[model samples]
Target: MPKGGKHVGKIASKGTSSLSIPGPPSSKPPDVTPSVASVLDELKSVIKQTQEEKEVGEQTLTGINKTHEKVKNEPRVSLYFKQKLQNQYVNALQAAKRELVLLEQCLKKVDEVKVEIGEVQARAAPPSTRNIDDYRSKMHSGLGTMRRGMLMTVLQQYAVEQQVWKGKPGESPPPLCGCVPADEKYRCKPADQVAARVRTEDGEEQWILAEVFSYNSHNHRYCVDDIDEEGHNEQRRYHVSKRRIVPLPRFKADPLTNPEALFRHRQLVLALYPQTTCFYRAIIDSPPKEVAGEYSVLFEDTSYPEGYSPALDVPQRYVLPMRETKKK
Candidate 1:
């Protein structure tokens, strides 16, 4: 061992660093030493093991990413709660009606109480100028009745719209496309366009515009869905059910804006209610690529005013419903 083995102290010397080549230990038994081929085989085995581990690591990362994506793109949970909310609303309506009935009894009681109190107060002290006047009370009393009537009238109008716009005319909006098609009918030209709105399962609402990119025999249908609350503003579903789903609104009696107007002039476009929002790589501030663990996404901006914003941010996913640039 001493004869063949090199000393570490001598190797550490800066002057001897270039000249040193440490040799194997000369042990007493030669049979215990591994052959050069065997040593090479061991190194190869370690290299192969490392490669296999690397492959497994990659596959694991891939699977985890896929699972995350599925969850990210899934439909919202709001739809499920909506029905229960409607049930509660019906219960509230019934309770309100009951309360209104009770209110009649209460009104009689209140009148009696007011009369008695007024008599006592009149006897106890002279009527003050600050006391609520009878006329003002009467006016305030009618407000609740007027509110109920207004609500009923609005509901009736919605019913009428539903009857008239039940999937009328035209096919559903087209699915998000990868590229602008060449066929004039399906191709989205500023000149040829129609906008519409619809209520979603959640009772929230959204507005959408359908402009054909080009005409084709097998043109894919646009996916749109929405909801509304208290008639305040629009709300919509990100993922529209795939089918020929149409909208409640129709082309205006007359164009709000001229044919050349992009989205601005059209009163509806100015009211741009995008029931759906598509996040393309080219457009939006936070595209999927920039957000590493992100993906290209489509979401419905249910709060669209009306036809305010066109479905401007179209999804750039797969080329859904492949069609030719120029139709045959």
Candidate 2:
């Protein structure tokens, strides 16, 4: 082997880093391998299917056994008839047994794959939060490349806006062109632009407007931007699941356009229930219905004076749909 090849092997065996030495200056980029996330996803899908098959096999066996038991208990049944029935049941039971064995093998294979993936993650993952930042950078680069023209225009405008806003002497933004890196799989999806309820650290709950942004396919989480009544707030971009947010009441009303007005309305609702955040349990109450484009919900705000009941009669535009949470 060449001298460089020997060094490469030594470093690789030591597992010092995931990076490999590149070829001389003219060499192409290294080939990418399948990500652990994709492999694990496939394995999980197969395991779920295998479990379903196992359940079916067990059910089949149970039904066959029940039929066989009933036939055996019939005192007037003929010997040949009973023998035929037993033979059929036996054949079915054997088939079910074979299926069960196959499913068990599939489960074993799934376990092995999971262990292998865990090992790969341990070996390849970085020690700090840098990996997440890198992932986000890649996603943005990919999007920029795919949307070169539009993204470039936006970038230019953003630069001019920054320069004008900063008013720094001789500190113009860098010039950009329409050559965004291509990101084939990562597509920007429209955010869920609706008002919802969220709790603050102090346990005080209030209604906030929010929009869905990009999604992280690897982590399977939503990049949500919580738009306060003042509009899009950069500080509120968080990775949140659907369960943490509750839909707002949509009494007979139009969507509020002004941020200040929206904020004030939100405050009014909070004032009605100052003691606690909004709560909608799955078992407590049925979902509100839209009647003539309006929704009627009972506000169980404890902040109200004793024996004071507040009901929400509003338009459907005020209520946001439930966000779907994926099974991890």
Candidate 3:
């Protein structure tokens, strides 16, 4: 079983409830409270003691074997005497085995306790500074005319980034672009999705999930959040041309186990002129032919463009529902 297997399972079974997008995973290091530290220290000591006990048990078994060998090899030993000696050796060996088994069980329990303590620490640590402020603003902003779906989706992505579900913050906010207010470029418009070029082990580059931190409005250069395919957050930023960054599809945050699941089939609006009111009517069954990981979707529109087909290739973050962007 996984460390958080039960928790993940519960989230999966509950359907999409508040628990699904609860607080994002914390990017800040876990706080080691004094009590937790003390508990860890105690566990370490217990492990040491159990190890010692196991060694002693092994020694006892060795001694029993030697004694039994000597008694069995003795010259002219009577059958009754040999039988009695063998019984004594068997009893000693069994006792030693029982002692070793008990010590092993204790060691296993100690590991379990350690993992539980770490989990508690992770759960207790607060979200990063940005998430706290963002969440606070959302709360205080009058609940009047709330776009519950949009708000939820925004929060989920915020949590994922802050908690670092798929990527980590760049080191020092990528050198600020003097031409464009670094702050302005960092802002991801509701219609835009952040993307970056990632170089793989075989010298191949792929565009993957990214968070834009800085952009040079003057030179068309951008500093984007760089991540590896395995989802481990990288500290370096990818500097690239403006054209390299692709927009993300619009999506609602679903309580899914991993980043991939969260990005899978979702309700999205076609990036067509927002005026036409184009939306993906159903979750796509699969991606377009020969294009892995890209969603192939059909749009529902009251009014259609002259050259438009019912199908298009859209990534999860790129799809925006018409309703969310109407007032923008």
- Against the reference, the lDDT scores of all candidates come to 0.28, 0.36, 0.40
> Candidate 3: where is the Cα deviation over 4 Å?
1-32, 72-84, 127-328
Instruction: Measure candidate 1: CA RMSD.
Output: 36.9
Off by over 4 Å in 2: 1-188, 194-207, 229-235, 242-291, 305-308, 320-328
Sum up the clashes in candidate 2.
Answer: 13
lDDT of 2 by residue, 1-328 (tens): 0111100100121113321211112332343235534444554554455455546555656666676677777778778667766776776566556545544444434433444444444445443212223323333454543332332232222222211111133432221101111133433355444334454444544444455676666765556655321111233665654454433321221111111112222222221121111223111121222112223344443455632244444323333333333433
Which candidate ranks first by lDDT, i.e. highest?
A: 3
Per-model TM-score, in order, reads 0.15, 0.26, 0.27
Candidate RMSDs in Å, in order, are: 36.9, 25.3, 22.4
What is the per-residue lDDT of model 3 for residues 74-100, given as tens digits with 9 covering 90 to 100? 777678766766775676566556544
User: What is the Cα-based lDDT of residue 212 in candidate 1?
Assistant: 29
Best by TM-score: 3
lDDT of 2: 0.36
The TM-score between candidate 2 and the true structure equals 0.26
Q: How far does residue 19 in candidate 1 sit from its true spot (Å)? A: 39
